[model samples]
Target chain A: MRGDLPAPSAAQIDIVEVGPRDGLQNESRVWPTEDKISLIGEAIAYGAKRIEVASFVNPRRVPQMADAEAVVAGCANAPGVTRIGLALNLRGAERALATGIEQVGAVAVASDAFGIRNQGQDRAESVGIAAGIVEMARRSGRSAQVTIAVAFGCPFEGAVDRALVIDIARALAAAQPVEIALADTIGIAGPGEVAALVAEVRTAVAPLPVRVHFHDTRNTANANIWAAVQAGASVADASLGGLGGCPFAAQAPGTAAGNIATEDMIYMLHRSGIGTGIDESRLYRAGRWLDRKLKGSSRSKVLVALPPGS
Target chain B: MRGDLPAPSAAQIDIVEVGPRDGLQNESRVWPTEDKISLIGEAIAYGAKRIEVASFVNPRRVPQMADAEAVVAGCANAPGVTRIGLALNLRGAERALATGIEQVGAVAVASDAFGIRNQGQDRAESVGIAAGIVEMARRSGRSAQVTIAVAFGCPFEGAVDRALVIDIARALAAAQPVEIALADTIGIAGPGEVAALVAEVRTAVAPLPVRVHFHDTRNTANANIWAAVQAGASVADASLGGLGGCPFAAQAPGTAAGNIATEDMIYMLHRSGIGTGIDESRLYRAGRWLDRKLKGSSRSKVLVALPPGS
Candidate 1:
């Protein structure tokens, strides 16, 4: 039971696979575009309906995602999949829309410190950028989603103000995006913080579906996800094999920053009786394939735990 | 809030350190007794009031714990530390008491299948053995704690009945041990299961303190701990570096069975505004030391996230 709030909006949650976009973007390895397409196809085969397949950022800024157009063009027409592309500006959004992707994900950081460092803009400027992208997507007849990065905490600015985040959500919601996702970019959040923030954001953006992107840096991502679900989040983001992290957040020493492993989250959600409509065995197979391609950098324990026969 | 139960009993929790005993027992490396003692000493230095330092099982069964006597002799007298030793039978209990350890941890399997496989006894026989150990500890004027293994689920028997676990708790509580710990031996439990079962068991054994021992085999241990805490569990068990599982449980392919990492749990609890009274930096230091000694098998993310200077 979610604390003093309505139960989760949906019994069946849509787990958006973010490995192709978020997971591979932070890796040191620049995977071949075919390999990236194969990974996205594998996720689709394993029952990923909503997938963030690529980021249309500058090729020099993020060389790993340089093939965003190619990747989207390759995987945009997968059967029964809603292909998503990340966009930080109108140009990126137009590029993504040109590829026939279904959804464009625009992002704005909560703090000016992070916004300037990450996107060369202040908080207000980044929000304006995201709003323009959302408007463009809507005018072009494509759906859009906005994510608030470091909604819980930030490395550049340390503790982010909740009131500031709520205000940002309110502004982002004003543009009427299809969904608003709150990202714990540094993986420092616990359940209480997630619950309180999601409740406030849900109220601020009435009727707009809220999602969460959690990092397992401190091993609290699963708990944070449960709390977010309890707080009425309908969609959750994860990376296959626990791959991915923000490049800016990787400067810290010994950081185990990664998205929650898709298979691991599926294990917990399935066991808890929450429906994700994702196939666990197929997901595991995808993870095994990813692990081999990534040369065992995957931090997912479930991939190693469920050996072939049992 | 715990579903249909009283609020948690305490604002602060006493986390029981179990790295030296449970963590080492599953490892192939037979650590030197001095290293074991130093680890225990480090836990004490880090404000662990209660620690499971050693086990007095047969050397032939668990060669890793063969230095139990030496480990106890070295760390049992640490000031203000309640040193605990695991005892599977009356003989082990007597050996633990002889070393002047403050408490003996006696365990009983909730399922007959697990009982026979793990201890070569049926459920009733294992309970009988545990009861004898508890009674002996009581007579010797030393405190005893009873752990119900596989209280949530069993690998061999599959899903364990909550009624059966409630019955086992009733039986163990009847022996009047100081604390009754319910262990998620196979790590299949989710927060909902944990909250529901803990609520039932807390009712079954009123006034007998309930502690939870969680395994992160499925990446749900942190959430399970939060559920257990909400259900009025005041004491939680964890290993220092996420380093231990049942030797018997390790035979299965992909059995990523290890106790919740103490540092990770502390990070969650502390960040949630719950007090553990343990020094975080010291805990990280000990983890780093253990990671170097154990050849870096420690599964703790916090150790890697928080570098020496950070």
Candidate 2:
């Protein structure tokens, strides 16, 4: 029975805090550069070893990340933490490398419809661009990772093909990125599908780590994250206060389609005897801080439901 | 290897719609008797075969359920549906049988602190009363099932012991109730804990179906529900629009700590190829109707994020 499956063998799973970048990028209100830096500092203080500090997208398209260089430079003093910058193409990759960010996150889309709308590229073109970005980062002596977005389902194209995702993983693996990630960009995946896909992707990118990213549009993000971890995913991405939504992804008019909350993820993981090396109490405080800064209640249940001291 | 576990062998899982009873009981705003009957009728039309139409508790304590008898009488003519009534003791069980409801749902608490606060009885006394209610229902030629509440964790006592839950399950199984249920009354269980406990409880009550209930207080309810189903639970309880929370369970002020939404559960189950026999589209309509009647938005993500026709 699945219940009897051995507990996750890894003593600790790496959590990639994406609050500063992905979490803030989707909000209509653009946060100041100082607040972004403070968010990263708080995350580091809460024991987040890997964090996505900013994305190197076009300023006009993603004005929320317009101060990426300033944000990246502000956090350069932090020691013993891997700062990541998300990039969709070689131009963004060059910009990220220019900032001396520790890691470059290259994104590839699994569907042509989403790819065209999201980054003005087709599926094949997106994969090639992501691979080129990885190669550029490697030449610059920085680590790079590839994330296949809409790997599970696409809002515009509907069901994404698993074979297409596998093919993308294999092609990206040749570039020898640090890991391959499968992203439920639309939050349309169930646990079974996540387990099967993560397992297949892990096999496809042998020896390379598997990371998982999920949106909570359908309220299955935590379950999908747990399923991915159980299927051998070693790293997962979450945002503080569950503050994120893809600006391009279709959603209800006023609903905040956020990612799985970082605090909630840590709570589930730590309570299950799984090590995340992240402090739950501190994350709760950080969530509250972010909520206050945004003048909005946190989308994370733990932050709202449980006191930080608890 | 866990991913390879065969899909749920059961072709169909029973979903006991608890919106009318558990859903409305927690809300401060009392829904009229006609609205309660309309909710039940809509649920039946949405293909829910079993429903908890009302509860026979103290009208003064749970004024939202003050019209229990009227709701029961209004729904009595519905055929092919097992109408369930919740009761905490023998007197309530007698009232349930007197109303000609199909099943009596007796609730037992696993923790003394929560048990006493929730139903004016401690752990041992609550189990004894639950067993007595089951016996009373059996004597009246009616079906009865016992639900062990706070089996995962308690608000006042914190972590509940697995041994205690198993003992209660064994005690309830001896009464030969139709099934045994474990409820996360305060929504504090992780997937790992849920899987292990459900497996143990299923073993203790061999051949008697295991039903699972959860509140999304901490955003782990869907994950926990999926884990329970994977661990061999044959039945689940959900509310329309995710419209239920324990009146006695501690929660964040102003936050709706509702149960897993019936539409969300159906979406996950049916998408994974497990049959729920419930129509997701109709559930969306029902959710919207409930939202309008209550003058509040649904707690269900699927209803808010996806269009009804989608």
Candidate 3:
């Protein structure tokens, strides 16, 4: 069996499935709420303990997330699974809390240029807004994960400063959210940069768990992820079938606008001897099902390369 | 630009282009001799100091490489470039040397099953043949590099033992070839396995100048390469446009029958602050040319993702 690898490192990492929210938000095809819920269930079956099911954003701006409440309602109460909902502001946080999900996710862009372009706020203003959401989640006895978008690079402002990212992460660290995620919003980070930033953030935030969100735009995300894990960041975000990327940043031809594929990550993590309770076979099936639902081929190399059942 | 990154480690690594030999050998479409020679020239212009141009295998078995001498005659004698010709045995090595190429490459499979299947010899017998080839190259004042095929996994015989790979490396170390390469022929290796094996092999054969050859079969090639480099392997093999895989192992579905793309590896290496001497724009153009010649898309993510002049 291909799964029979040399004993891997003893680190067990958690992959938070973000396809339903981050993936669907950018897809050209808006899957129905029912199909969206079904996809989340499939991810859960593939050993996704924490899943971001929907984003509680304005329906007018993001029509794909129009049925966020309904999607959450369908997936929130799964036994032992931590259902997450993304909230862009305090109102979005309230909406997420209303669904009774335990975790609320929000974004804080690192670059001022990307902050205004993506969220109509400057870096400080965006961090302030995210702080409000994180505070609201805490008051409601819910955990919050504030992801610093463009932490590695920006589309509008190229070459985001490492010090700027670290400063913003430090400021967010004061909010004491359950986790702080550094996102390679444009997928321009290599493993060296990732390791440097993760080490800095891990030291800055200390006990606050550091998570990473990577887009495989340049095909360096897997190596970047390995580097991050080696640098003490335990959590990462992945999409089924390697689906989803920031729509604005994905306009370039053949840009991999997707997060790393769940099955592909599972394979790497498992073979590295890092425990990720995921079932590889089930994850492969999820990728296949996602491909059919999207009416296109998946970007996942493993899903395409390996035949079913090894 | 996507090129600005933290000061990369002060390590300059060598990327040996294998597209012409390992890549074209397995390609279903046999590129014309002129096109093959042109590709080698393009790789040279893209800053490939070491290029593997052809293999002296039986023309009947690998008809694509039948014009090895012609191909070398065109690429050899290029200023500051080392042309390599792969030979499976002394006869092959002699043929390679006759082409006036300074380097003769050979293979020594780690698994007995793959050894028998690929070279019609068992592991010990194949190592003996490779030793003889090395001896011939040494007497002729030609450099030889013996790549241990299926160093990580084998298609016919799965899960090659680590001890067996180390044992093979130890045996070959006595021959004192110019370089020893560990090839993940089936691309089933992960970063942990790669680190472990490279560490063991580096210790087993100090100062042998360890090199790595990876196929992106499981989407873990980049990570594996990263791990290998971290563990002190300074040389890696890549194919232009991510071309080539072992034809024998590529029959399976979704098998990555190609080595990592040269342009993609250059991108990662350069961004990591590891200088590869490869001009990214020139490499991209080469990939574009390769795609056109092959009448298919280039498998390089960086080549396809970014637009011109980015």
Candidate 4:
């Protein structure tokens, strides 16, 4: 019913599910590899065609996603669904490539402080990492997406110089990643900033697709996403049930937490008649499952609330 | 520091804190009239130059605001504060005018469906009420603000036609309420929708100030507020911590059940080095008092949390 809104023609956006990696990575709980795989399968059923299953980071650091390979192996039979893995370094990239997944996502933080805090590298270093990962993914004939986190405003540095973000985006443009996503990692962006940056990046990247990732920390993530949408950025990242924000980040650079919910975004787009191939009912179920797994109630307004008057 | 955002000198903006009236009116738990007044005083303490202390609605319908007169009396002495009473109709307006509050706000839903469900009136009928209230206020040399609730989207009718909202806004423009606030009564707007509407309203009402009230029902309130801000609508209506929404509207119209926190908005704008003339610490206190009076925790992200990256 929501999808039939505005009109049937507006639903053309694609949402990439980031909960299995972004969601799980932030929680203190360690889901069993089996449970993690089940989460992935549920997301696929709930209309997640492309899902970031796990990050190939050091197990010592992110003990929860240590079984990245197993999760992908389990998801090998997910029909037409695309399972992407996150890679932080060369080893992570190599491990991701070996999983036979056709796509991999590499992250680069925009602020030097956050880059050191989050990526253990500064801007230039992360750019080099992106280049390496892009080369490997290209060699493997797989799709690569490089995301620039904190591209709008940084919790550490604050209002990152636009020139700096564009410079990295321009460099990543050369690597020719299948996509580049600008992330408001701390939820510091507004729609104007989103539009301005996305417009700049769209021009900088020319024909390349751009995606925007936003955290609902300031309650503006979805609007920023919409701003990005109008600016010609076709891809967006959302977590189910609004799950996932780094616990450390949640304690520090946060007043609230997590990425926008998948179903909520779908509902808005659907209501506006924006085309996203996600199934709302399935996304609702995925939200329910994530809520149970996290032992918490979901925060997605539409997924849980029955109807307006109800 | 989010409110500390640096920017070119801002055009003068007027803010109306609707917490006591809009925020408390819809809350289910009946806060005592005295506690309500204390909340208003605290809201004023938090740098709200304009505060809506209470709604002069019928006590039978809204028992929470029964002592509207007393609430206004309590916050009257806060120096430099402009107090506003919520007047729903002619009777309500008379009661508010009798209380000696120099300014009052009147509301009507633009969507016929919403008007019937909430106001028990048709769109045209409600607009007439608003026009009458504006005339009365003007004759009395009192400033009035007429708000169009559900201006973005309606629950029963789905996406409200922009043209319809625009037309009603056009009609209201003729009466010239000191300000016209567009309410996302249910938090149904996205950034693109927000930008388009703000631009439309600005063009329609040349020099009159436009205020935007958002219910972070769909995690887009802050971003939409930002969009509205850049669209030349400078004033934003935010509860202490996004504490309330239309009980009729409910939640994740995105996630994280709440309104956009006043402190959060001020912080967002402030940290960007924008000037809000608000103190974050005072906002936290107001939020805490509201939470205590309600016998629950404040749902505001920034108010409950200390400071981002603290």
By lDDT, the best candidate is: 2
Q: After superposition, how far is residue B6 of candidate 1 from its true place, in Å?
A: 17
- Candidate 1 regions off by >4 Å? A1-10, A245-256, B1-10, B245-256
What tens-digit string does per-residue lDDT give for candidate 4 at A232-298? 8888998888777532254576222567888777776665557788877767777777777767656
* Residue-by-residue lDDT tens digits, candidate 1, B85-195: 999877888888998898999999988888887767789888889988998888989889899998877777777777877888888888889878899887777776777
Q: Residue A32 in model 2: shift from native, Å?
A: 1.1
Clashing residue pairs for model 2? none
Weakest lDDT window of 10 consecutive positions for candidate 1 chain A: A1-10
Better by lDDT, candidate 4 or 2: 2
What ranking of all candidate models by DockQ puts the best one first? 3, 2, 1, 4
Model 1 CAPRI quality: acceptable
TM-score between model 1 and native:
0.94
lDDT computed for candidate 3? 0.83
Taking chain A of candidate 2, what TM-score results?
0.94
Residues A127-201 of candidate 3: C-alpha lDDT, one tens digit per residue:
999988888888889888899998877777678888888888888888878888999877778898898899889
Best of the two (1, 2) by lDDT: 2
Better of 3 and 4 by DockQ: 3
Over 4 Å off, model 3: A1-10, A245-256, A308-310, B1-10, B245-256
